[model samples]
Target: MRLHAASLYYFDAVRRAGSIRAAARRLNVASSAVNRQILKLEDEIGAVLFERVPGGVRLTAAGEALARHVVVVLQDFERARGEIEGLKGARIGHVDIVTIEGLTRTFLPEALGQLHDRAPRITVSATTQGSDRIAAMVTGGQADMGIGFDIQRQPDLRQAAVARFRLGLVAAPGHPLAGRPWVTLNDCIGHRLILPDASLSIHRILRPLLADLPPGEGAFVTSSSVQLMYRMTLAGLGISFQTRLGLEPELARGELVHVPLMRQGEPMWSELGIYVRAGRSLAPSVDLTLRLMADHLVAVAREG
Candidate 1:
C-alpha cells in the first residue's frame, strides 16, 4: 500500500504538461518510463488520472478530483524541500512561469533582472509562449505563475492586473509607411505585412478590425519569431503589427517605426495579469517573484 514519490511525480508531470511526451521532456526521462510510472500511480490510487483525447490528454472527472489533491500534495512537498534546502543556506527553488510574447521581448528581461537581484540563489525558469498556451499552463498546473494578457477568471485560478498595453502598426524605418502619421486597416490589406499569426493574442485582437478582408489573407502570418519579423519587415516582406514594447529597441534604433492607426484611435488594449492557482500557497521564491512582478508591472504602467 506504499505510494512511491516517482509515481506521484509522473502523475503530476503528465497532468501539468498535458501529454506524456511533454512530461518526459520536462522530466528528462523516457516517455515510456513516465507512462509506466503513471500506470503504477493509477493502480495505487485506484483511479484513472487522464483520458486520451484528440490533440492531447485530458483529465477525467476522477482525474480532475485527484488533480486538485495532487497539486496541493506536490506543492507542499516542494515547499518542504525548499525549506530544507534553505536551512542549508541555499534558497534553491523553481517557479514555472508562462508569458505572452510581448513581455518576453521587453518586460521579462527587466522584471527578471529585479527578481534575480533580489533572490540571486533562486532559479526562475520562464516559458515564452502565446496567450492560449499560458492560459492552459496556468489552469493545468504546468506553470506556478503566468504573466499574460486577457486571462480568464476561472474558479481554479486567481489573477491580478500587472500591466496594460496596446497594439501598434510597426514597420522598418524608412519603409514606405514609416512617415505616415496613421495607417488604416485597408492600407495594410494588400501590402506586405509581417503581423502576428492569426492564433496570437495581438492578431486575435486585430481580427475584427481586419474582418472585412477575405480569409486566407493577411500580408503574412508569423508565430513567435519577433526578430525574424523585424528582419522580414526590414527586408520589405510586409509591415508588422505588434505591441509597442516589442518594437521599442528597433524603434529607438531607427530600425522599426511604430505607426498609429487611422481607422481606430488606438489598437486593442490588453491587460497583463499575474495568475496562480486559486487555492495554492506559493513557495517563498515564487512569492518574491510575484512581488517583483507587481512592482515591475507598475513601473511599466507608469511608463505607458
Candidate 2:
C-alpha cells in the first residue's frame, strides 16, 4: 500500500498545513520527526522546499513544482484504490475542484450534497476562481476537475459538459428597470450601473456596452467582488449586470428581479464549461462526483 515514499507524505502534509508543527499535529507525530522528514526530502532533491516564515511556511518555486507532482501521484494512487473498491460498492477518494464564482452560490451546494449522498466516502475540495485560473488549475493537475466560463480550447483539456445562459440585469424590485420586459444599453442609460470588474470575463462583454453610453452617464460602481455588486443592487443602490445563475433565490423571494439585456436585438449569452485534464483516467468516485455536479448545473442552466 506504500507506493510513494514517506517523505512525500510529510512534504504534502507540511504544504497543506503550512507548518511542520501543524502537519505533525495532524499526522499525530512529533514536530521534530516531521521537520526531519522535510529536511531529508529537500536534501534528496537538492533544493530548498519551504521558506521559513513568521506565522507559517511558504513554498519556494521548487516546492511548488514538487508539490504539483506529489499531489498528482497521491491522487492517482487514491484513484487506483477507488477503482478497485468500487466493485464492492465501497467508493472512497478525494477530488479537488475549481469553478467560476457564479455557480458556487447556486449549483455547488446542491450538487455537492448529491455527490456526498451517493458516494459517502468521497471527499471533495471545491474552490472558486475566475475562468482562466480555473482552467489553469485543472490543466496543471492541481485540481481533479474544473468548471469555468468560455475556457480556451487546448489539447490538454477535455470539455465534459456545457451550459449557456443569457447575461442580464439584476435589480431590486423597486428599481425602475425591474418593471421592464427587457432592456437595451440605451434603455439602461441614466440608471447607475453596478458592474463586475475587468478580472471577470463578463466585464469584457459589458465594457463595449458601457462605451456606447452617453459620456456623462458613466457613474457606475465597478468591483472585483461579486458579493459587493449583489449587495449594492439589493440595497437599491444600482442595478447589477450578470447572469441569472446565482440570483434564483432572490428573484423567487421577490427581493430582486432580472431582465434580459439585449444587444443588436438579441439576448447576450454566456457559456459555462465543465472540464477535466485530457488523458487522465478519473477514479469512479471522482468521475461520479464530476458528473453529478455537471448534471446539476446543466439542468439549472437549461431551465427557462
Candidate 3:
C-alpha cells in the first residue's frame, strides 16, 4: 500500500516529461485522467503546481518545492517496499543509475557484467550524462547512483568510491608522438591540438599545463564533444588529450596509442567518483551493486 497520494506521482511524471500528454503516454493513461488528478492535487494543496507553456508545462515555484519533497518520499517509499519484499524472500528489485560516457566504455560494462552474475533478478536502468547532470540526478533522487569524473559537488550527494586516471595524449598510430612512453607539456607544444572546451572538466586540468604553450604556437580546434575529439584524433586531424577511460577499445587495437601526460616528470591525473544521494537508505539490491562497484573501482584505481 502506498502511503502518498497518487496525484503526487502524476505531478512528478508531468514535471519530468514536461507535458500532460507526454506524461500520460509514459504512464499509459489518458491525458484527461492525468490532468484531472493534477487539478485535484492543486486544489487540495491550494497552490498551482504547473503553468502552461508552449508545447509543454513548466513547474511553478510551489511545484518545485513540492517536487523536492515528493521525489524523496517516492524514493524512500520504493526503498521501503523493496526491503519489505526482501524480508519476505522475494528476489526482485529495480535500480536507476546515471553516469558519464567515459565509464560506459570500460568500468560500467565490467561492473554490470559482475552485477548480472550476482543479482540476476534485479533490474537496472542506466543513463549516460555528463558529470554535472549525473550528480544532479543522484542528488535529486532521480537515480540510485552516479559514477563520473569531476562530478559537480553538491550538498545532497556523497561519494561511495573513487578512481584516478592520468590524462594522456591520444594519438593515431601514424602520428609523430604515437609511440612515446610519455610526453611532458613542453613536448606537445607546436603540435596541432584537439582540446575539450571549458564545458568539460579536462579543460580545467589542461589549463595549467597548456599555459606553458605560447598562444598561436600550435593549431587548435576546441569542442565540447568527447566523441568528436576521439574521432578527430583517430582521423589524424590532430592529437587530443584525454584519460584512458573511453580509449580502451581503440588503444588495445593499436588503432591509437595513449601517451601519458607528465609535468616536471610527474604524471597528471583526474579523479572519478561514484556518488549516491546522502541520508537515504538503499534497498538490498542497490546496496549489493554499490558494494560490487566500490570493490571493482577501488581495485582499478589501485592499478593506476
Q: lDDT of each prediction vs. the true structure?
A: 0.76, 0.85, 0.85
Model 3 stretches astray by more than 4 angstroms = 211-213, 217-220
Clash number for every model? 2, 0, 0
lDDT string for model 2 (217-237, tens) is 874888877888989999999
- Rank by lDDT, highest first: 2, 3, 1
Error of 2 at 256 (Å): 1.4
User: lDDT for model 2, on a 0 to 1 scale?
Assistant: 0.85
Candidate 2, which segments miss by more than 4 Å at Cα? 14-31, 51-61, 212-216
- RMSD, each candidate, Å? 3.8, 2.7, 2.0
Candidate 3 Cα deviation (angstroms), residue 228? 2.2
RMSD of 3: 2.0
* Candidate 1 residue-wise lDDT, 59-132, digit = tens: 88888888877777877677677777778877678888888766777789898888778778888778887776
Best by TM-score: 3
Residue pairs of candidate 2 with colliding backbone atoms? none
